[model samples]
Target chain A: MTAHAPERPAAGGSAPTAPAPGRAPRRRRSGAGGAALTVLTWAIGLAFVSPALWLLLTAFKQENQAATDPPTLLFQPTLDRFSAVLGADFLPYLGNSLTATVASTVLVLLLGLPAAYALSVEPVKRTQDVLFFFISTKMLPVVAVVVPIYVAAAELSVLDNVWTLVVLYTAMNLPIAVWMLRSFFLEVPVAIVEAARVEGAGLPRILWSVMLPIMAPGIAATALICMIFSWNEFFFAVNLTASQAATVPVFLTGFITSEGLFVAQLSAAAVMASLPIVVVGWIAQRQLVRGLSMGAVK
Target chain B: MSAATAPARRTAAEPGGGPAGRRGARAAERADGWRRRAPLLPALVFTLAVTQLPFLATVVYSLRSWNLLRPDSQAWVGLANYAAVLTDSQFLGAALNTIAVTASCVVASMLLGIGLALLLDRRFAGRGVVRTLIITPFLILPVATALLWKHIMLEPVFGLVNFVLSPFGAGDVDWASQYPVLSVVVALVWQWTPFMMLLVLAGLQSQGGDVLEAGQVDGASRWQMFVWITLPHLRRYIELGVLLGSIYVVNTFDTIYMLTQGGPGTASSNLPFYIYQRTFLGFDIGQSAAMGVVVVAGTIIVATLALRLIFRTFMSAQEAK
Candidate 1:
């Protein structure tokens, strides 16, 4: 779980060279302190996680007891809540979310890869300024652009279309994709690129046949983070999409109906909507830490 | 070997010393410079087209008075819309609320995140599981986060919070009703604390073992180690978290929208929600665009300062370890 460092290849050689004789004293000194620290961490960790636990419990309880006064902890488990949320025209919104997320992630990669390559490999004269400009685009709040974009979309007769959302998602994720990919690209040994260059390869050929192959894992990590961000995006999806392109978040928001039965259903829908991303996060824990930090720590 | 037999027209990137014997190489270098920028142009231009053009159009709209509901009533107002937006009571309230939400959420989350990261820095059983559990909130969907808080956790009557506090006879208090802004801020803190935790955790883990051992050998107290050594190394990372967290929290919309819809009469209306209400509900296109321009201006100022700090602190000392 802790091994996301780019110097991972060196660990194999450095492992046995460490001071094995000093390990016993280190372990002895940590005996009591470690026990107390472990218990404290467990307490705080569970406290932090109680919310998700509450959501899961709510998802399984009967509707009448889901939000009962003082709450009901132990109740008969039921699947009816899941059935309820699933019954509501929810699948289409899920599909729309998937389409926009997948398509936009792909588009960001298509455009961002070469840009990252240039920035890292054959940087322009003012590479930092260009990178700053890219980050600047991301810093522009959604409200600023949404106003004019809405007007333009209305003028172009393309409001409320999924394809429009595809475009919005791409713009929203592109700068971040470039920033992250550039950092990942920088971690590749410059010596390898020089070797590739010595083989009489042009820029495109080197990127395609050499850099891409070696950086496949980095690219996968980048793609996963992009997909996660796009999937969880709310502001653009909610504003740009209404009927035909409303994503899972918009669908999940429909549960504000405040009926007795809908509370449990809301929990069920929440669980289903969030399960995939949470699992993805869990599986890619190390890469996620690197991506979240923009590769600063890694 | 390459220099002897290869082409003499190497670019400036070839690093030949003193610009000595390369007449053709200079021209080639200049041309190569422009050529190297080719791969970056498409993405750059595409981003500009999609992002900046709309902002440009917004600037134009802000200068003129336009109403989506009454298209024919449009007329050039110059800076009048900006004047109105600046003077409006709701805008002031929303602006203050946004600052409050952002300041509180960032400060609280960063503190809590640092505490957790420090606690988990040691090797313990089930360390991976504990870290995963703590970081789970950040992975949940935003709208779902709002729902989980609004309905299931903080709803006053039927919430788990009340249930947990029921023994004290204070369980039935309606938190959302009493503290609408704080309610949303707390929920946001819950979601973002993990983000800060993850970043700061990486920073803590990255501390050099040799440096730490030297500190211990020098008979430094744990508190001294933290105050002098640990804190200095973590400043840039903490600042990075603040910058990123502020950017996200400033535009925090979904939670307020779902939880209270900015509630009780602009009590919880941050800038984004206020802007939403203006354009969609009031259809005051000019005023909303004006507010958006103000937001963009504010963001640029903050971003420039943040970038300078991050770059100065981190990149300059890159090889310190």
Candidate 2:
């Protein structure tokens, strides 16, 4: 019964506001407990994050240093690993990743926008059912159809093209993109759209001029998540690509030649491969959280 | 880009004029709709042409007697390929292994996610950084994750895990040879548990503090609160997470491909790896297609169930509200 937090009084229509009750004083008393709770929270958080920190630290050390007798924290730092990783066919892989990721993301947004708009503002019958249909695509395992996909790719001679990935990634990422963007579009306040329509503005015009700017942050977050998913995708990239079209992850596999696994070089490749996404994640961590949480925090 | 290109073409095709063009405008709008839908057509056509065509072809092939080794000697031997796949011990083992590994990974990750989410739910300093760090695993390339576990951490002597254990008289253990399935399961859990945590945490935060506070006011213990309220509230999310997570687990090839290659004696082969080996390595294209068909059919059934369950829960929640 207490679950309902008085819903945001319907947009632009102000409900009579009431003064604060006993909550202001209660917050003052809870401050000390909140601090302790915060510490416990951070401890739990750090414990969870330790694996990633270790992975980063391991990246900086030599292969032998990483596999040391005691797992050495102090190490002879070297840029040679970085240089070696950089000097490989790393750039082309990076290019492939960029092309596939950017293309797929843009494609998803383009197709998804109209679909979402039609589903929302147009009040199409069974829109929710249609929405559910869209989301259901995420349920099937890609590998189930992967063999067929491979055969298809080969037959079409799109074996390693970034465009092949672009298409597949678009489909793979479409479900979630549509799901997320639909919710965002729904939240854009239909009355405003109607107002724009009343003023002779069309749906596309309203979407471009009025709705998109307000929803830019959410849209960016969705695109970034799609980008990450596309970038990290390996099974398809590995199978579909051989030499000319391999992504960074595929190139990273070169470290495991028949001569045996080159642990040092592989680690270097991984570190370099993950750097772009990691940096992006770091800079956009705030936005990532915001988008991922579906604006629950706000 | 193809999808985007569709709309631009539609707009370009339509010329805006005054009231005289109003009737034409509606017709153009209809034209534009179909045109805009066209761009998505190639993508869909490609998906159907590739994935669907091969799928149907596989089904047909499954009934025929065709060996990749002698393509010219292929014959129409109805149901022999199916009988072969059904009777094969490797297929049976693979089916069982696939079920066991997928189940273990899903259940373990869900539990770990719950534990992590519960711990991370409290208001705290540095929570943002920790949150980002925890999700790092999900972001790491799967091949790299597999390689790290297979070569660096799970190596018998020098691997960090073994080195730490060796001091306690835990002698060198070949992960693939000694405990192949468990090794694959662990690697998968490591990669996927982060996903569950992320989803579950999002669910928990969205549930918010009010009902929890009310439960506390009623003198409910943490156990009672979770059992009576929190769990029910999170049921939909857990279902969604489990469903998506299972999809990832079942389809996973890179981990098994890189880590064990389903090897040391086919100990770690799941459906995907089984299909891969049968088709590419063993050159049993017909049987591989059969295996691929089975995997796809199985996945479709499982995914349908998961989706229905999750959707049913969501509907009930809406009704409750």
Candidate 3:
């Protein structure tokens, strides 16, 4: 399933068209040009990332220095803003966010793993139809159901509940998790499963002892992707939760009304809210492309 | 196979034979099918309950007049809300804005993404670091990204945009307030370009080196090779990127809410934000529900066509492998 495997050229294909002897001088001539292009690539990359870098810098600045004419570049960096954000009751929102994100991701894996296995490895009838059904749910706009969700939540008296978010986020991410996990399941060879079956290992035993060890990294990648989305999700969080169960994004909304008044404090809060997922995403950069495409590209 | 045969053999040995044995075997097979499907049931049932039920409720709600602010206003309206939604100037405006935002963001980000992917495809020093830097914006919280633009980067008096443009005599211009749609689009494009780039980069890396080398030997120019080979191979990846990107971007609310609040008079309100305003702010449940249904209807029409195209591409890709 890895797209990185290059196709083998035919036996006579490369032999007749071989230009290997000319390659050395061509490579030498292009060395300076390559270096120049690398520098340009580096510059563009930095420029593309500058806004996030600016946010990092602003988080360390004082209130006045954070938003100054000519955008204060040199300044005495301080930790006051972070302290201010923490002191201002930021922990509850952080706890709620962690609870929703972690709980939902775990739930998604629990439910999605078996479904993916059924669809890929053992494949009950109409496997493609089942896969399409899952992906179609993702295409259904969240706004279409928010009104009912809100009404139902109020009626059920769970409007500001963290568990409500956990459930909704599970549904939100389950489709992608299933698709991605299915792709991972497909990559596992049939021979291994047959070997386990031949050993008289039951379904549960085979999954626990043989399959999970191989699928651990894929599952971790799926979990990371789910956490990233659940952490950053604002639509449902803002509309559904109030003070009691408001997640990090909902806490950020508190700054929206106040706007330019809390520039440094806002940056500090944003940094804290985004840091965990950003670090996780950076660590799983290679898996991200696969996860984002629902493993279609890979 | 053994279980089916054993049952048949015993039944044949008994007096009441063929029909009874076939029926028993069919029943056993049905049970076996269900057993195989047991693992899929929990997810399927959960998804149906959580996702589909609310949608069903939305359709029912759209048919009735219910306003949270106006207690006792709940009554069967029979498509009045839908009619109102179709005629409402604000709804129409938001629909247009949604199209503008989704289209421009996807197109702009994809073009920029192709360029960035091409640059990263080549052997370069510190390429890993450069790729990491490029993808960081996407990893940041959307709310944070919106705030960064709204306050630090686009603020008139102390904005980074103005400061960088000061040498060109550009004054403190209120970019968010004056050009709300463009500001929102810029924020969204920044967040999405990395996604497009990653997909395109995967496509680029998956290319067979032998083919490109063959092209070089055949005296094909770089541009010719890219056009004839690279672009054709990348079509499916690009399609996937655009489809997925549009689906997410069309539901954009955080950027609108944090940056402009769809302000300067609803100039930047996409469908999701507009529906939020109607439901939460206006407390017009029936109207918003109707709008939601309309949005879904439009999405279904577009998605069905797009999904068919992508599904074929995906299946063909799978078969090719």
Candidate number achieving the greatest DockQ relative to the actual structure: 1
Better of 1 and 2 by lDDT: 1
TM-score, every prediction? 0.92, 0.82, 0.92
lDDT of 2 by residue, A274-293 (tens): 77777676555544533443
Docking class for model 2 is incorrect
Q: Which of 1 and 3 is the better model by lDDT?
A: 3
Worst 10 residues of 1 chain B by lDDT: B1-10
TM-score of chain A in every predicted structure: 0.88, 0.81, 0.89
Candidate rank order under lDDT: 3, 1, 2
Clashing pairs in 1: none
Per-residue lDDT tens digits of candidate 3, residues A1-298? 1122223122111122332342321222267787888888999999999989999999999998987776788999999999999998999999999999999999999899989887877766667788889889988999999999999999999999999999999999999999899888877887898789779997678778989988887888799889999999999999888989999988888787654568999999999989998888888777788799886766
iRMSD per prediction, in order? 4.3, 6.6, 5.8
Task: Tell me which residue pairs clash in candidate 2.
Answer: none
Query: Which residue segments of model 2 deviate by more than 4 Å?
Result: A1-51, A126-129, A257-261, A282-298, B1-54, B67-69, B313-321
For residues B1-321, write the lDDT of model 2, one tens digit per residue.
122333454457577888878778878777656643443344334434444555576777666666667878677777677778889898889889999998999999899988887766653456555666676776777777877777667777567777768779887887866898998898888788777886676566556456777887899998999899989877767876776677668777888888888877877888778877776667666677677666667767776777777666544543443
Q: Candidate 1: which docking quality band?
A: medium
- Over the stretch A44-105, how does candidate 1's per-residue lDDT look in tens digits? 99999998988988899888888787568788899998888888988998898889889988
What 10-residue stretch in candidate 1 chain A is worst by lDDT?
A: A10-19
Q: List TM-scores of chain B, every candidate.
A: 0.90, 0.83, 0.93
